[model samples]
Target chain A: MAWYFSGDKAVYLQIMEEIQLRIISGFYPLGTRIPSVRDLAEEARVNPNTMQKALTELERSELVVSQRTAGKFVTCDEKRVTEIRERMSSECMEEFLSRMKKLGFTEKEASEKIGQHCAKNETDPRN
Target chain B: MNEILVCSDLCKNYGQKTALSHLELTLERGKIIGLLGPNGSGKTTLIKLIAGLLVPTYGSLTVGGNRIGVETKKIVSYLPERTYIPEWMKVKDILDFFEDFYSDFSRDRAVEMLTSLNIAVGDKIKTMSKGTKEKVQLILVMSREAELYLLDEPIAGVDPAARDYILRTIITNYNENASIIISTHLITDIEPVLDDVVMIQNGTLRIHASVDEIREKNQMSVDALFREVFRC
Candidate 1:
């Protein structure tokens, strides 16, 4: 899918988040070299400088590492990768739960609804 | 730090009608600057001045520390709003013309782009669709290894698909040392690809800032900001 962007946040931050998603999802596996700034910018249809800024931010956050001669690569630290994955998943859960709360559902009721939905999905032939 | 173009207190006049006034802007190398404004707002005037087509009536404008002359013209590739090529020429003929005229013109690169777009070299310009002609013109302009590209409404007359192709071509063709200035009113479509935006209003500079800074500071897209700033 094309990289999604909205008007509310900074484009570089959005790009940074997208790269983080890719790193966590193994689309760019651990220790694998990511695309160059030009390639990523072209793929995302953004300015190359903006892509460079996003990559620089990623490097600062330790999620990506730049070798001197070679290109940038995703960090190979399994613990750090797991930490980021868990953090992102938790953020998603927090947003979902807060939204559910706005709909007047308690935490327990929301979990129960999710459990029922997953059970139904598993039993369906489409699964 | 590498400023490619500088304009200081620049003014342009057409016998009492001021097309530009007291404009000061500096553009760095390696950036894609969006020159945005509504109709009659002097975007074209600024671009023309930079392209060395029209002389400024007052103040100073320079490209790469050189006055707008034969020297600057050699490094500036300009794509006017209209299709400026003769209709009678074939695509191959135009390619040859560009190759003969500009030392930086790369026939191999232009041909590669044409072949990828499935446009035949033998096709006459008059027979091609409007969008195809625009693409051909853009390809020829971009194939040049110029220091700066001044494209006036590159995507304005094309389809959405063609617009995407044009944008991609622009993104991939420019090297790190070269910069581009795309003047158009289509803000949202080109916002993502721009590093900076120079917004003009009624012959004055309204805003000159980075796209990310504008988005972060205003919490709105550059298009929304333009509407708010230029609302009638």
Candidate 2:
């Protein structure tokens, strides 16, 4: 379905990211049962084995846990989800700072520029 | 789970013109392999050998642990590039023939696909458009639930909507234990669905790797890599 793929990155990694996004975005609410491997694979148009691997990764990261006889569930821990969200925001800021630095802007100049840019644009998509 | 297909030093020759040479590879279950090459890169020859239509000159090939013969043919469902069914037969007639010939064929699945595509069961094959004929052939092949699906140019000469339909049908119908190999020149259209890619040049294997690994190593899509590698 091309829902979890951008045709550039690894499919399983993308699947992992997508599931994580779902957890943090509350599409998969805390402690809710996630889709089975076969359903997720069918939805993502990937092999079930690939889906299994991605789910394994999620389990390893403690974002999801598997119960005996039951299915995988998103962790009920909201603190962990917030931690991931903050980590992603920090990474996004690092990307912005490095990009502005490459354009010959100092850190303070970059910060001031961001402030001025955000003040000028009512709803900056980039911002 | 056993390997779906294995080839060892596989070679084929037509009176000194080599069609395939030293083709050693192994395919596992639950994979969607994309067999890609230019016009004369032995793509069809490899597919034909697996389909049991052609014999290799000096090598061995096996499918589902059986040699390329009746048993292998029974488990391997092939869709050749050109139309192979009779023109006069109705679509329903073809479904019945497939069901009779292959024990794995699901008549209900075929009928459901035809109905969903707005294709009538009583419609004659020759009367339908080329696109409809192709869709019918694809539906017949896919309904079999074979261990291995060898599709040769299944999406060629079709509209985008039809292409999407064909891809979706393939993804939904195939089971995890079976594998599918799609041989096509339309790389971009089938790139997302491929798990592995096998590319040959001048009757020799050039590249065989997983799709994710190729993207990670080359930093480009499979289609772009094909264009660069086969550039004149």
Candidate achieving the largest lDDT: 1
Number of clashing residue pairs in every model? 0, 0
Q: TM-score for all predictions?
A: 0.94, 0.90
lDDT of 2 at B2: 71
Q: lDDT of each model, Cα atoms only?
A: 0.92, 0.88
In candidate 2, position A59 carries an lDDT of: 92
| TM-score leader | 1
- The Cα error of candidate 1 at residue A116, in Å, is 4.7
Q: Kindly report the docking quality category of candidate 2.
A: acceptable
Segments in model 1 whose C-alpha atoms lie over 4 Å from true places: A106-126
Docking outcome class, model 1:
medium
Model 2 chain B lowest lDDT segment of ten? B186-195
Residues B39-75 of candidate 1: C-alpha lDDT, one tens digit per residue: 9999999999999889999999999999999999889
What's model 2's lDDT at B173?
85
* Candidate 2 local lDDT, A11-61, one digit each (tens): 788888888888988999999999988778667766666678889998998
